[model samples]
Target: MKRFLGFIEKEFYHIFRDKRSLFILFGMPIAQILLFGFAITNEINNVEIAILDHSKDATTGEIINKISASKYFSINQFIEQEADIEAAFKKGKIKAVLNFENDFSKNLVKEKQATIQVITDATDPNTANTISNYINSILQNYQLDQNKDIKIVYQIVPQTRMIYNPELKSVFMFVPGVMTIILMLVSAMMTSISITREKELGTMEILLVSPLKPFQVIIGKVVPYIFLSMINAVVIILLSIFIFKMPVQGSLFLLGLESVLFIITSLTLGILISTISATQQTAMMISLMGLMLPVILLSGFIFPISSMPAPLQIISHFIPAKWFIIILKGIMLKGVGISLLWKETLILLAMTLFFIGLSIKKYKIRLE
Candidate 1:
């Protein structure tokens, strides 16, 4: 019993001494729980929406005020005309637009009913559905409030139109998200171990003594994975198109170019991970734990980013997957060209350069 107790104490000491173990045991759980608790939510708050008041009457004004008063949505803009709605959605700021039919108050008084068209950008179908429902609920409550003392009960009918994805196909949303995850993880996981494996197997010294330069070594390590990841991306895109009947409304050439850029970004990030890590296991852990959760949760793939707390929303901007997902959705669903997508494209390019530069610096440090 004394010997067993001594062994147990030794194990505890070992665990406490290793920072990685301590982090895994205590830090990771706390972080994961906090992230999950905050990130994984269905309810949206401060979702940006637009209003196109055709009637511009007291009734429309009251309804708009009620929607704006709710905690669920914020009125981002008041659109001028019907033609601008498509342009607004393509800009990717507004999620839903409330279009009050002409003569709304007069119709409510004379015909005892009025129609408000709820047009939503359904690239993310779940969010679009939720927005439509919330607006409908607000209209219903307003109707009830106005009908309290009247013999003729007034009705406000909400007609919801889901653009881009009229059927609200969940797959339309998931394909882009899954594709982003696959490209991010596979590319990162593959090259993350490249340098660590060399270090572990005593081959790093051989490379160190070779005629090849540091950049040459780094490029050599990453170039193969670039081709492999590209193939993986092509396969995923083809499968999505043929099997799922997913449409690529934008230019295929542009899509290919963007995919290549993201793949390079992910691969360079993997190289950076490889340079910093001491062991293959460590590299793998960092790549999986550090990359996967953020990609899934904060990328606005599963949940709306605008719905999250202000801090998480700010942190999400740092997530490359979030930008890549935006690019994919823009190209696939909205069919917007590079003119509209230039900002996101530039952000990915900048990230790629940043990762490459950092990897080179880290590699030089290892050489010294």
Candidate 2:
């Protein structure tokens, strides 16, 4: 019994002393909990939307007021022409639009019925569908209010017209996730290994001493992998489009730009890992433990962030993939341009700068 206890203590000593082992055992669980909390959720709130009130009547005004008062939606803009609804959705400014037909009050008075068109950008079908349901619920309550004196049912059926993806394909939800995972695996894992291999061979030190600055050398090392990861990204997109028939509603140029930015982010993160690790095995383990799990499980790729716990929901904001997946869905599914997605774009840019800065700092520390 004494010998067995001593053996266990010795093993624990080995684990605690190794930084990588300590990180894997302790740091990983904290990271997982935080990621899951922030990234997964089953609720919706504060959805952006537009209104096109052709009726412009007293009743219509009241209905619009009711919708605007609800916590589920924030009216981003008002459109005059029916043609501009498509334009607003393409710009990604609003998730849904409430279109009150021209003779809304007249029809409601004479026929006890009127049409309200709820147009939605269905890139992320879940969000679009939820917004429609919320609007419908509000309208149903309004119907009950106005018809208190009448014995007839005043039905205000909301016609939820799904734009971009009429069929609400499940594949559309995953294209961004799958592409993110693939690009992450390829760019991050390989870049870490390649850089660590150079470090092991003493080539990284030689390059550091060359005419090129450390940043230039690191960029030179990662440039080739960026091309390779881009190729992987293109292949994934092509397969998603051809096999799944997932529509690219947004600009392809913008999609390409976002993909490239993600690839660079992954590469920079991998470089940071390489700086901390001494061998290829160490780099690989760090990349897998640090980047891959958080991205795959906690990035809102498979799970809805609204369903997650409050603490985890708050923590998920720090994951880079969470923002990138959003950007992907907005472009590929919603057909939204950069104008509507600037916030997510800036988040990704900030993450990239952070990783590069941290990696450089570590590299300088090693030299001393």
Candidate 3:
């Protein structure tokens, strides 16, 4: 017990002594959370647009007024000639161009129908689709008001139930992803680099020659990381709850348990990396470039798996972060219990076993 405490104390010194790494470990979670929460979101607002109204009537004027009044769009430019449309788009001032057909009011009154062409830049498909949808919604509302006296034959109202995140809070989606990233950095990157540092400095050889068993030395090194990762998880959860007003829909105990499991899995991976790499730099590079990118891009963290190409979607299944995210979403948003998440939990367990087995095999090979 005394030896274990001393080892733990040494680990704390290593963590606290380096201000830069400590700052990165603690600061990155908040920074990433804020960045993803505010900056990278599916919702589009205040999109700049251009208007080309050939109608020059009450209907076209009202349509323009309606669009400009809404929060989603701002009428940045009004093009006179048809040729200006391409120029404005090329300059990138407008994302979409709303054009009212000639004699819109006259046609709507006499023919009981009107046509408006919404030309959108398809380079950014998501933004373009959102802009078009917003415009259509505004027009539909206007048409509903104008036709208040007339009865419509077909009334199709979309019953949209935004599952997982009912309120469409981008923060909800980010919480799990942020937590995973923090755990990955803290457990995998930090442990692997710290272990490799000892190897680089020749302290690892001394330890291996000491009375401490190989597993004991590795466990002593990893225990502090496990504790630190858990602390980070707590910090992130508290920040989400208090700072961002994110609710804990499921049991806190379950969340903590799953976090611990993921931390262990990450630490095992770190152990494997440390055994394979001779220097801290290599460990850090591998952890960041190899593991981090896949977690962020392929784990359904930043992009939806369903929308991805078929091959990519199949490949995403192998990412451990994907399972972790699924477990998190089920617990945090859907408020599901072990019954729903047992399969994911089992998969994580299997992955942890696989990583630990591989690390042990690699370590044995090194010893021989």
Best by lDDT: 1
Error of 2 at 252 (Å): 4.3
Query: What would the TM-scores of all predictions be?
Result: 0.95, 0.81, 0.60
Report the C-alpha lDDT of model 2 over 264-355, residue by residue, as the tens digit: 99988888888888889888877877777777766778765555566656767888888899899888876678888999999989999999
By lDDT, the better pick of 1 and 2 is 1
lDDT of 1 by residue, 212-295 (tens): 975677679888888888888899899989998888999999999999999999998998988877779878988888899999
TM-score of 3: 0.60
Give the whole-model CA lDDT for all candidates, comma-separated: 0.91, 0.83, 0.77
Q: lDDT of model 2 at residue 239?
A: 94
lDDT of 3 by residue, 237-326 (tens): 999899977777788999999989999999998898898877787688678866787788778687645444456667778888989987
Q: Using lDDT as the measure, what is the rank order of every candidate, best first?
A: 1, 2, 3
Q: Per the 3 Å backbone cut-off, how many clashing residue pairs does candidate 3 have?
A: 0
After superposition, candidate 2 runs with Cα above 4 Å error: 1-4, 18-20, 197-221, 249-254, 278-286, 293-318, 330-350
The TM-score, computed over Cα atoms with residue i paired to residue i, of candidate 2 is 0.81
With a 3 Å backbone cut-off (N, CA, C), the pairs that clash in candidate 3 are none
